[model samples]
Target: MLQRKFDEVVKKEFPNAKDAKDTSIHYLGKMQIEHQLDISKVLMATSVCSDDINVPSTTFFNVLFGPFVMGGLGGVPFVGQTGMTAFAHHIPDNGSAFIFYGPHIGITLEGDLGKMYRPRMEETGNSCGALMLALSRLQDNDYTPVINDDDYQQMKLEESLLPYRDEILGSDNQAKAITEATYKIIDKKIHEYIKTCKNEFHVDKVTLLGGVIINTDYGLDDYFDARNFEVIDLKGL
Candidate 1:
């Protein structure tokens, strides 16, 4: 019933879109999810790696919470609410609930997406282009027409980036540079969060599930471990 409702919603919103055929994994999880999908909780980690800019909820949720989990995790307040409300229309009141946030987990789902969706590498430079490529591959798919091809070009111009070249993005140094920048952002946010944390909620075992959890460097894993919070690399699963 939930699946049927989701299909109806998706079809209503994107009339031209095709329902991705149900496969082994979907089948396996279908029945359980219809009832109690073991995992009771979920957290979405979106990217704030780049400077603050607006992004659509669908894009963010796909990057943050694709690959169906036990419960609904990533969605915006408005869209997610509507979608989940539609979902709850079928679900029992005793079933699991859902939630969403604005880059609460610092997952960096846009790792390569921001740069890769460009039509011309000449327009945005290779770093951004490569990032898009990385995002596609990370999501196990390629660019579709829905993505804005021109966004990267405009972003490049805003950043005053140099000419486009594949070399800049395909290098170990480039990856490291991106990683470092992301870490700085994460560090600041986490530090701020830790400082403000004065209660049990701060110390509770908070599980992180997003792109940023993939990083073993920056001691993110260690930091969470030390705090006794479970830093789950859900992306790996």
Candidate 2:
């Protein structure tokens, strides 16, 4: 049933596409060069930790070769670049410093959180990294995001009984509360990053990219307001 629903969503979103593989290939080929360069800058910001630390050589490699890899196989090179950039950007140039990159949320530098949160392709449950999990649990399965199998599912028996308050809540008020709470956590983390890392690193702007920006009904604009951040949609480029 989930597969059928997903297929229907894809068909509705890309009606002229021949199949999934074809859609992926065509979509990958549409990535503009200017957009790739903009993404490279965000990848670069992830590396800014201290004065002594220099940009890693791998950063350059990813920026240059990322498109080629994506052409051969569909994946975002910037996602993996986040970790390497954080490692190079640390103040002491030591291995201890870390950062968190939530695909749907945004980047959270070290010190923003008590500990590092590993990036997961799917949100497992109602934990610190469960924004996607809550969205997955929404009762109206038709309102699904453009995510993969493990992350997007029809609500369970209990989840379907959830009461809706408005469009933002869908038919699952619990899911709405969870999703809003998760965004609050992420918003707080970003402010903390601004307080500690922004000036030290000479950071000025933030950019958000991914399927979540387009697929999800939630808007991240207000969360980033007055923070010098902009959301970019490569598909519209």
Which predicted model would earn the best TM-score?
2
Q: After superposition, how far is residue 22 of candidate 2 from its true place, in Å?
A: 12
lDDT of 1 by residue, 1-237 (tens): 543443444334224322222221232253246434333232233322222111221232432232222111111111223332243233223333222122212222133312211222233333233333333333332323233456542333222212222333455544433433333333344323322331213112223222121111111110011111123222332
Whole-structure CA lDDT of model 2: 0.28
Residue 14 lDDT in model 1? 28
Task: Looking at model 1, report the run of 10 residues with the lowest lDDT sum.
Answer: 219-228
C-alpha TM-score for every candidate: 0.27, 0.29
Among residues 3 or more apart in sequence or in different chains, the pairs in candidate 2 whose N, CA or C atoms overlap within 3 Å are 47-89, 49-89
Residue 196's lDDT within candidate 1 is 39
What are the RMSD figures for all models against the true structure? 16.6, 16.1
